[model samples]
Target: MLGQDPDAAQELMHSWAAQLSTRAQAAAELSDRVATIASSAVGANGAVRVTVGASGALTDLRLDDRVQRIPGAELAITIMAAIARAQAGLTEQVSIAVHDTVGTDSETGRAITDTFARRFPKPADEQPDRSERDARDGW
Candidate 1:
């Protein structure tokens, strides 16, 4: 009502429509980039390899012939580690893509990156021993 001259109202509506169109285009492009996201990693000594998709779902896995040299449990651990690394790589790619598309400071970008970061936290250097901590703290 404050700025409701007919021509001014028409111009304001046009500006709002243009802004919405731009956002729609940007979202579409981001979707396209995410749809193609993938990352791969190989385990130490090349015994295992893995690839993960945008959602951190495993798309491929490979085991070198040398994997037979390791015990079954060790080999399984190696494979799981490789898959985790691959998923981490995929999360990094998604973060970059979201930053590029929506700007890291924007609400959409922060939401996207924060979700991935929470879901795929960086591996810790060493896990704390709960028993040791409890003993030291007199728990």
Candidate 2:
């Protein structure tokens, strides 16, 4: 119907353009929020803690004096486990961001969620606790 009326066609096009612009703006805002998201997790009964950015890059790591009791190799494992735990939770944090912004139904949201899921699949929950392991070994 709008084909024969140039003014109507123009108006229709303008409406579509406005909708597209709104979507683009929302996506941009979502990207900014997601980029700023930082996830943290603790492991080995809080002896090791780590924070990771949206890119799963380690941003901060904190080890209390309790770590001095850990063997060098065990400490390395603990640190890595903490990082993995942080990375694993990154997706959920980003999922909330996406849901609040563009929403999970959008293609952009799905892609963002999928990428994080693949990059930081959950770690095994059976990671040995520092105290328990040490006690078992009579350390």
Candidate 3:
């Protein structure tokens, strides 16, 4: 008959429990930091305002009465731009949280930042090509 070592088994159980506790603490801290994330932006002379949550989801939007003076298309563009800016700000906050928790060089940190970068790309100044328009118009 083989006999089991009680002391060794007890030590192993304690080690596992400690590891689990440490992981739980880290997860809790990350959750708290993420919950604190909120970003906002104002657009077009404060005619439009936008706020985004930690995951870049829009949480709130406000339009000033002056927005009525702008054309519909222009107002739409301004609102969209504001939302994009707010999303970008949220991504920045998430990047900081990831860096603080997992280190920027770690695989987890890299994946998080990469995801945000791909999802919320930097805004660019885009205009229709004048040459194409002229050709189409036969000017």
CA shift of 54, model 3, Å: 2.1
lDDT of 2 by residue, 12-126 (tens): 9999999899889989988899889899988677878899998999999998889898889988988898788899899888888889888899998999999989999888675
- Candidate 1 C-alpha lDDT tens digits along 95-136: 888877877887877888888778866655522233334467
* TM-score, one value per model: 0.81, 0.88, 0.69
Enumerate residue pairs that collide in model 3: none
* Root-mean-square deviation of every model: 7.4, 2.3, 7.0
Candidate 2 root-mean-square deviation in Å:
2.3
- Report the Cα lDDT for residue 126, model 3: 29
- Give lDDT tens digits, candidate 3, residues 43-85: 7666678898877788899987877776787677777877777
lDDT of 1: 0.74
Candidate 1, which segments miss by more than 4 Å at Cα? 1-4, 126-139
Runs of candidate 3 with Cα error greater than 4 angstroms are: 1-24, 126-139
Off by over 4 Å in 2: 132-139
TM-score of 2: 0.88
Worst 10 residues of 2 by lDDT: 124-133
